[model samples]
Target: MRKIDLLFAEYGESHQNPTNKFIHWICVPLIFWFILGFISLIPSAHVAVLYYGLISVVSIAAIAVVSLYYLKLS
Candidate 1:
């Protein structure tokens, strides 16, 4: 199996119980959306200028770093 699929299969083993699985399905996305919305409310401060040259601010930079980390893991 592919690496991502194998990883998911192993992770899925823990949530095999129906109640726990149901809780995760319901809560996880809600929690993610809430957190994203909370972060969006933060007032951004100027952080840096890109080499090619767009101005970067704190909130956008934070999201970019997180996105890059996930990309690296994948």
Candidate 2:
């Protein structure tokens, strides 16, 4: 978990560059949406589509804000 967190921190640092940040802003949510959509195809997870959708939106928003904040700081 610690390693994963460190990796993400490094990734966030790289994304402070405007081009990389823009790419991430677009790709991240799309990747997450596809992931959730794939998971929702599972029988058990299908029932929780709304929950997953909300979480995905919130996560994307949070990431966007954080990325922008870091970009501004850098």
Model-by-model lDDT, in order? 0.73, 0.65
lDDT of 2 by residue, 1-74 (tens): 57667888988787788988888889988987776566544444112255444234444454577689778755
Error of 2 at 73 (Å): 21
Among all windows of ten consecutive residues in candidate 2, which has the lowest summed lDDT? Answer: 45-54
Per-residue alpha-carbon lDDT of candidate 1 for residues 21-61, written as tens digits (9 for 90 to 100)? 89999999898667766775677654455664433364576
List residue ranges in candidate 1 displaced over 4 A: 1-11, 45-63
Local lDDT at 7 for model 2: 86
TM-score of each: 0.50, 0.48
- Candidate topping TM-score: 1
